[model samples]
Target: MSLLQRLIARPPPPRTAARVAVATELPGGDEVDVLWVRDPRARRLRLLVSERGARLTVPLRASQREAQQFLDVNLPWLAAQLARRAARDVRPAFGRGDPGPLPLRGQLRPLEWREARLLRIEERDGSIVIQAPPAASDAMVRRALRDFYIAQARRDVGRWLPAYMPGLPRAPRSVRFRPLSSLWGSLSPSDAVSLDLALVLGPPAAFEYVLVHELCHLIHPNHSRAFWREVELRCPQWRALRAWFRGDGLALKAEMKRLVGP
Candidate 1:
């Protein structure tokens, strides 16, 4: 690099005058550079990186050294995760062409646009179908399916709770929706089951497997042999479904993200 080229290189922005250590090493074994992003509305530190640079946006109340140390310890894990994410990358299958028909619960269903007020499921000439009314936009279709699936999931779970665990108290009384980036669902001790809305777009088998797994938790809170035995008894194909989800979860999650907007 010539001295003239160095002199012509851009200088740091004023907001990032204070330097911080970055969380990852670059491809050439160089430590990545960090830029401080301060926003008064920020309530915590947010670290993000891109080809341009690594950025650490911090709240006014944050302890810079503490945040840096935390990132340092987690750097390798973060890098590995990011690498995996980069490897399993996907692009939106929407607008390019029809994603064509999708299978739901062992039935082939086509997604169609119609001008109607309600999102509905109906059987048509020996085929089960999901339809969005003509006024329905992609966002509406996505949201309606999410709501329908979660509600149906709640009812389905409610029905099995009693049959599986006779005389069990409360019967898994409440089912709730939540966004979980890691797992599909969770069952709290208070009879509340939190389901990931993202699972609605997964393969039908994966969706059912997760629902059954969480519902089984109402009886066995821990993943004990008895709990798994219960899962196997209720969902015989669970192992295969689990393996499928493991391979496809990232792709499904990416689709969900696109539907909801990244």
Candidate 2:
């Protein structure tokens, strides 16, 4: 084919729309940025709020004016959600001269910074003490804090996993921890289990319930009656735990994210 014909036959690149964001003020005078997103798959206008801010998604068929009206109508709802977050937004600003009362293993512990030969953390007398160099940066402190939390979480899992192991079909190939946005715990197809690190910031009972729940998945992968029965066999108080999580889990996740940064 001629070069011109070949050029003509080539399909055009997909159109990409630039992201749009607008600022809106709350009733209490707090200004928030709302990102306007256009999605073809969205059937109607939707507003999503988080500690970061708000996002307004619009269907392809909707106009910007319609979207703005929808946002105005939902501003009150957003305000209420933000208020709830404010109550839970208690994680301290680290690295500053200010000491903290950070959440740890289901309770709030006072945070203290001290100068020591090594940059490390130690919990004693119901307080979290970080011994850092006189000139250590905030990022260094945050890393030490993150590592401290992970180590503590691993300690909990180690203590609890063996209890659930003998009854399971087999041991998990592996287990991992991270900041999961939507799930408390998950069992991979290979029988590996992954859990949210924020569980360490909640009640120990809730954390163990998640471990028990995932370990049972090795024998029954689906949430059928049999799986629930197995879960009950391992975790008798799971019903109460579920109710507690429904009330506090998401807020715990947001709190953890804020503490650790992103």
Candidate 3:
């Protein structure tokens, strides 16, 4: 009985090969970590590049060699992307005598910092005055500035929300603000609208565009043709506004990063 049972069981067929990963150095001397993933549903190989690094997704039948080959072929593109990311992360030193004005509401507003008993920000005569405590550090001053922007975003977004509501299927249940890293705005399935506080640095037109974009999502959750049509119908100049946000808005984000790391 024991002999027959052992012969029939066959030790669970010796299991398939486990997934593996390896690190390889690019021609530019940058190291890339490659993961060999087994995705049953994957129809073909795909490469994803990000600030962190590059990732290769492969089908179950693919080998580690294939993944490595893909990385080798895409090394140039990967290197350029990594270089751009490195440059983006290198924030300019923000202190006395920095050139130009601070970006606020899509315009370069004069930045004035001074010592005071408490931190306070005020907008007077086309200038943003920031008063920090005597012992306040740069990070502390940055925090105060961020808080000011968040408050400003809240006020501005609230004012703009009402103007776009009549075009939507129904007004959002609520509007909220957050300091988001990667998203300008998002519409929840529960009818809540959340906007990025960093958006306060962008132009008023860009802010209005984002608000309208999220509002359209209340009717069509996906970016289908119908959803975009609705957006175009409501905001005819949305295309230009979007282009401005992508170009100028990114500059604002980089400046904010310089002020407040990450």
Report lDDT per candidate. Answer: 0.58, 0.78, 0.69
**lDDT (tens digit, per residue) of candidate 1 on 207-233:** 778877887787677777888887898
- Which regions of candidate 2 are displaced past 4 Å? 1-82, 86-93
lDDT of 3 by residue, 1-262 (tens): 4432332223222333233355757777878675544455455676554433556666555555575577789777656655665776766755433443777787889877777898787787998888777777767767776777778887897787777767777888887866555467899889999887767777787887888899999888877789989899878999998767544554555567666455
Q: Which stretches of candidate 3 lie over 4 Å from their true place?
A: 1-84, 92-100, 245-249
Candidate 1 regions off by >4 Å?
1-103, 106-108, 117-141, 151-162, 167-170, 200-205, 260-262
**Per-residue alpha-carbon lDDT of candidate 2 for residues 182-248, written as tens digits (9 for 90 to 100):** 5789998888789998899999999999999898888888777899999999889999999787567
Which residue pairs come into collision in candidate 1?
A: 114-133, 114-134, 115-134, 116-134
How many backbone clashes are present in model 1?
4
Model 1 C-alpha lDDT versus the unseen true structure: 0.58
In terms of lDDT, model 3 sits at 0.69
Q: Assess the local accuracy of residue 243 in candidate 1 as a C-alpha lDDT between 0 and 100.
A: 72
